[model samples]
Target: MRDSEMTTCAPTLLELQWAVRRDVLGLADGAASEYVVPDGLAPQARLAIYRNTANSTLLTALRLTYPAVQALVGSEFFEGATRRFIGQCPPLSAHLDSYGGSFPDFLAQMPEAASLAYLTDTARLEWVVNQVLHAPDGKPLDLRRLEQLADADIETVRFLPSPAARVLESCFPVDVIWHAVLSRDDSALAGINLDADPVWLYVHRGTSGVAVDRITEEQCRFTAALLAGRPLHDALVDGPDAGTSVWLAHLLASGCFVDVCLSSQASRRATGRQVA
Candidate 1:
């Protein structure tokens, strides 16, 4: 073949794949033109199958990640919403399960979803649950080891959520709504007054598997601060209502922190005190 013909025939694999992806995601109109089809072969129809399959896969993944949202909005509405969502926010990574990390934010921006203001928070809850389920396993922080430290040492150290732990705060009753929908308890759903108080949630892997607990606002604040890599002392400053001794005991018992970060000097001090 001539040089020009060779060039025309040999589009890079990446270029073709990107064109197909754009078409599947509805970002472009003429992806099928990238391919040469023989007589009697309908390229548009062939591409449509791939597009439909992509949409179906995305819908299934979304439903799995946000089952509560799907149940709350009903199948038809959820499907329609997801169709739009996938178009606007196509998967950035090949990992399908991690695809909808921004789905809650996307739902928040939708006009139809606005009436159900809690929907976004619900999505957030589901996403967190999904993430916690997949997080790595680790030994929780040892409470006994923590107790040997002095108050000043404790203050200077930072706490980390166990690989299993995730904290989320919502202005809506996200935990209640999630449980009600999943359990198919209509009465429970009915009793949830939308005007009711906001909620703080701690989703983590428990002894029995994944568990979601409703924690206090102070606990949520403290947890958020810790997750942001703040020292325990600084984290406690935001919420005076979070009693230091009480929460320390509760969090330690809850197995929330997988590891504690004590400075090199503090670690030596703690070790020496233990030896003494």
Candidate 2:
């Protein structure tokens, strides 16, 4: 077994560490006094200091990832929810950015946020933006090379989506909510119609930085298939429900695709990248 996977701490020390974790999360305590060394502070007091630091650190991480969600629901409320969320789903990754992906789901299930149906979707959108912002830059596909492909070869071409590309669909107009909350437009937030058709959106890194786009359902379907590494012919097999060429141009122009390869050569190609 890998050293990390093996028990490195002595039994008592490991038990105390686990106890400290439970204490930090406000879970059942493991009699910290027995494990901790005698110091100026009592064991529980020392544990309390750690608890404060842990909660504060995790809270900061959540705020950074879900700023819009925090803005929508006031900071006080957000902090309370985050505390409960931490108790339930503690940090799993050393990187804080990877820690709160499940926070949207946690909020969705919260009784306090039950009235705000759009809250979950808004948080989900924020998570996507956070992810895209942190993802590695991808080499944009050369459209000229695509033009060089013969008609038969074009159909068999498989496009690789940018690493930062993501799609989201929500019954609520989450894009509007995101913009309004981030911009602190109380008027826009107040004017939102909760009962609207689902909006399909894509989050991707643009020429400038992370950006979101409002796309049609047909466009969503087409782009989703391509994002899953489907070939051109298969991605269009069903219905675009709109002009194929137009949607294709829009997605390509939007930096959704990063590289291209022949469907026959996909398995043979070891990596998703294409070298110049």
Candidate 3:
């Protein structure tokens, strides 16, 4: 064949076979060819061992991310759930940490988990905890700068929640459910009820470690507004029962708010006013 004809030819059968073998091995399914198998082992058996190892490694990662969910569902049920979850939502990111982001939603729709309505939310909280642990740290807002703002400026300033923070709301009492699963002792079980109304929760990293706190619906809404870049006045317009001063104090005390920004117009006004 001429050089041009040879260059245009398709891959050989051996090349195709090798490609399949590499793919299968990378996915932990072992080589499809018997060439690599041990003398005593069947090709299928050797391949099965690879499949088992791959699944087990994946399952271990999944378990680490969704420990609370695993605890709630028990090991056997969680194993089955993880297998189903993997089949439906294979890892898309190179980082294993990015995997299992959809696991909570998957559990919510699962018939086997229907009875455990809080299971999905618990999983979600666990996921948030993982995110907080891994999120990049940034310097918090300078309280000194905050003190310089006039009362009116405070109304126009937007506050940013910490990078390591996440808010979760669920119809099931997910905070209580998380506590039940994570707490070493269950002594405070008197008023704890799973069927109670939904609750809002905040999970964030602190000086010690990742921590979860139960928060009010109003706090959730206010924080969400701030995070969404709404001005302070606009955020407080629909905030829970308190005057702006009182609400601002409460927010500052929460330790969730970390940064601030003034609207462009407000910043210009402040500069002009100061210059005048």
- TM-score (all chains, Cα) for each model: 0.83, 0.83, 0.73
Tell me the tens digit of each residue's lDDT in model 2 across 61-82.
9999999998888989999999
Tens-digit lDDT string for candidate 1 (190-240)? 999888888888888878888888888878787778776677777777776
Go through the candidates in order and give the C-alpha RMSD of each one to the true structure. 6.1, 5.6, 7.5
The candidate scoring highest on lDDT is 2
Q: Model 3, which residues run further than 4 Å from truth? A: 1-54, 147-156, 184-191, 243-247, 250-255, 264-276
Ranking under lDDT, best-scoring first? 2, 1, 3
- List runs of model 2 lying over 4 Å from the truth: 1-28, 31-35, 144-153, 240-242, 264-276
Give lDDT: candidate 3, residue 88: 67
Residue 125 displacement (Å), model 3:
1.7
lDDT of prediction 1 = 0.83
Task: Give the least accurate 10-residue stretch of model 3, judged by summed lDDT.
Answer: 28-37
Comparing candidate 1 with candidate 2, which one achieves the higher TM-score? 1
Best by TM-score: 1
